[model samples]
Target: MSTEPRSTSEPRIAIVGAGPAGLMCARVLHNHRIPATVYDADTSLTSRDAGGSLDLHADTGQIALADAGLLDVFAALARYEDQAKRRVDQHGTELAAFVPDADDDAAPEIDRGQLRRLLAGSVPAGTVHFGHRVTGVEAVGDRYRLRFANGGHADADLVVGADGTWSRVRPLVSDAAPAYTGVSFVEVRFDDVETRHPDVAALVGTGHLFANDGAGLAIVAQRNSGGQIRCYLSMRIEADWPRRAGIEPDDEAAVRRYLLDAYRGWDARFRPLLTDTDSGYLHRPIHALPAGLTWPHRSGITLVGDAAHVMPPLGGWGANLALLDAAELATAIATQPPGTALTGYEQRMWARSGPLAAAANEGLARFAGAADHIPDHRAEHQRYQADAAAYRAARA
Candidate 1:
């Protein structure tokens, strides 16, 4: 059940969810001296654990930050030297390594927490109302009334859904829901890798390391700012495999054993990724919305980030696209007439994101199963290079 909103004279612009997209939207609106409020379910910025590092591209993520007057801050916080990427076989044989030049500012790594904090702080105090869990949104006249779980309510002339994968505001504009990909990741963390786990640190190098067996097992380790290495051991299994097998992610011993059994014949070096953990593993089942998803023109509602086009992280375009969406949507709102601005923004967003979403899903399907049939690393490298080139061209 929902309640009707009491009359209020002040007009409001509301953005839901405080992830990168929502925060970026708030920042851009603030830069234009527009009055908007951000609503997030989290009690505080640090209430829970933030995700790992993210690489921001020059054309998308960096451009958005620059528009919000935070590019310099991002540059300062970015891990410029950690742009290297390496792919290897299960036996620890190097497949291909992408080493960026020193002068390259194309894509740089930054901690997700650091980036979110920067965006959150740049906006005016009280602009973001944390702990406001939006329960439902209903149309009231031309505006929308956002009802929260805490019995609080606000009416906004426009509502932007940046609430991530399970967005509450998404149903207003579209009926699309995310479907799980056939892969799942068990995340493991290693602290002070330089001193605590030098072997793993050396193997991971200065940036990202990927070891795949081509069948169903993959170990991906990424170097973070604080001498930390985050590893995700990916496996292709049924969505309910864990529950069916009675595997408890919170049980470290059971997880370690399951991983060891799964990769029994693979290289021994990959053991540390599963064995050397600080605590219980975190299960991350991949999910994505259908490619080319679109909605009918609904006034007073829009979406960004995972809420719009949630795809597997294999393509590394989620955060970048989210930032880009915020930039473009904010511009549309500021420049176009209120009646038609949201429609214009949706058109542009679909044009830009639809292709990327389709490509990402295609890439995921091809790469996830290619290890069995395609053992040649160079071939994989060439395919990746060609795909990347095409994406770059499209962005231009």
Candidate 2:
């Protein structure tokens, strides 16, 4: 409703997917008085849970939000105390612990749902057209046209693909596909932890705890607002193992039993992490595009976020990089004309993302094997600190 006037000379921009990257891009463009339309598959903003919490890095996520004029709102919603972190062994022994100053905002945690709402709300009401799940994108004489699943179509001078990992728009530019990372997470959530599970809450502390066995098994538990904690029981297993074992996602009891058996040697105290799950388990196998992935420049279309360069989430780079991509792409579009802006954006994006993606992939390998290969928690702790510092420095 608050869109700027459409100029005859201004390119008509169509953004696919209303995730952080797309929303941020649109918000930044709107701030520059550039109008763009965002299309998403969801029927409405609250179509589903927005996944778990995220820690927005200072340079990427925070800066992007600032550019979008939403930093103040983000600060109001950020959970500063969630910076507390700990690493432990199967016996629940703390290998490393970091409790940042309560005021630290360098990388504050925020629920993904909350962040999505803030970004979505920041843009004008009608800017995002919900339920417009894009099915394909095609070039039409120097322009791009989008076809949606629900029998809809639109054409734009510029098409921004923010549709995420399995982006439909990606094919128009690249041949890459997301391949499994040999890692899978059985996601479990517990609600009202402070009241219903005080002991678990105390063990989890203020932020997150990583319990690794140094081989192939690990559990990461992180606290969100509303006294809830989300846990991911991760394993390095065959991609089809779940289906092969007849383990359906909705079979919560079966999943719980499987997890308990897989982590049998783990400390008894950690059992509650699996046994006390409050909802159905979700089997989410991690995947990433080939590291350092890039496509030749094609006019009228480009990608951002997971749609551009997806990597394992081990290095905490996914959301941060996505937000950065959105901001950078928006800046490029705002300054350059349509045909040439994408080249500049892709060049800078690849330079910035290529190394990060490679590092993230390597780090994920180490992280997946930390329980099995790492000699000791102390060494892992040191590596964690070094990686954290390095990421901060790189961003700085």
Candidate 3:
């Protein structure tokens, strides 16, 4: 319920969507002496759920969190020793890999639940209006009004659509919708990795692993926190393929069988990944917004995060970029007046995020075909690239 009188002139801001982008944006604005109300469809912080884990990249995601003064809190939740990595083929052939022992700490990762808690807690007690799924945003007599499905409405001076991929507020700026990327993941999980699924544990080391034989795709194992490994039975199919397969998201058995069929030819080393799954099987179709998707700036409204530009998860840029969006938008608002700050924010956001979106699409192409086409690339690889450059510079 903390409200800072908005410069005694500017109107209140409404940030739609309570995900990373929305929450980070709110936090930055709150820190900058701007009052913003965050809205989400979920009834409470625990209303739905937070997923597995994420590595906060130092450049983007971690930097943004640091800017918001949440880095130490995040570090408290990060699984530092879980940075081990391994990649294997179906025959249990150890591919390129690295897994931190009890001592090594590479790219530490944080559990989604902990990160979500940090974001939700950082905001003022009542700044977030949960269960308020925004339906539409329109200009109402010089003010912006948000119409929710629950028949409630709120007005603000500026409305930001951090609502994510199927953003309701997207139409306010552009008519673009995310296009099918022709990739689907049958997501399965096995909890208590060390104690429960020994075979899968043998197959998967730590950190992450990729097993693709250029036949079918099976990304199996290794997650930070909770001692669980998430396996993805990736398939390239038409947009309607999941429904055609009769896959029920809630029915783990049905989806498991479907994945077993899809990845049938792979090495038996893959069995423990699905055979020991404790969490139910699920189907998730990957989709992406067209790269370079920028719209004309309309006053009193803007888009942020996945609502602004959604791309494949391959780039590891989705959450990190979203968090960065919040940081930049907050910068714009905090450093300048609403009228000027918004314009600067949109311009930089579009410039920065648009290319990353395109890069994501290019990366998605590798995962789109029946056989994986793109070469393997991980965050460590990027780090190595930077390290090599530094080494060369130092040697010279």
Judging by lDDT against the true structure, name the best candidate.
2
Candidate 1 per-residue C-alpha lDDT over 132-197 given as tens digits, one digit per residue, 9 for 90 to 100: 999998998988889998898888888999999999999998988999999888888889988999
Candidate 1 stretches with Cα past 4 Å from truth are 1-10, 372-396
lDDT of candidates 1 onward, in order: 0.83, 0.85, 0.75
Candidate 2 per-residue lDDT, tens place, 146-239, comes to: 8888887887888899999999999998999999999988888999998998878988998888888878888889999899999998899997
Candidate 2: lDDT of 293? 89
lDDT pick, better of 1 and 3: 1
Candidate 3 scores a C-alpha RMSD against the true structure in Å of 4.4
Question: Per-residue alpha-carbon lDDT of model 3 for 92-179, expressed as tens digits?
Answer: 6766655444543334688777777899899888889888988888887987788888887888888889999999999988999998
TM-scores of the candidates in the order shown: 0.91, 0.91, 0.88
Native-referenced Cα lDDT, model 3: 0.75
Residue pairs with colliding backbones in model 1 are: 214-371
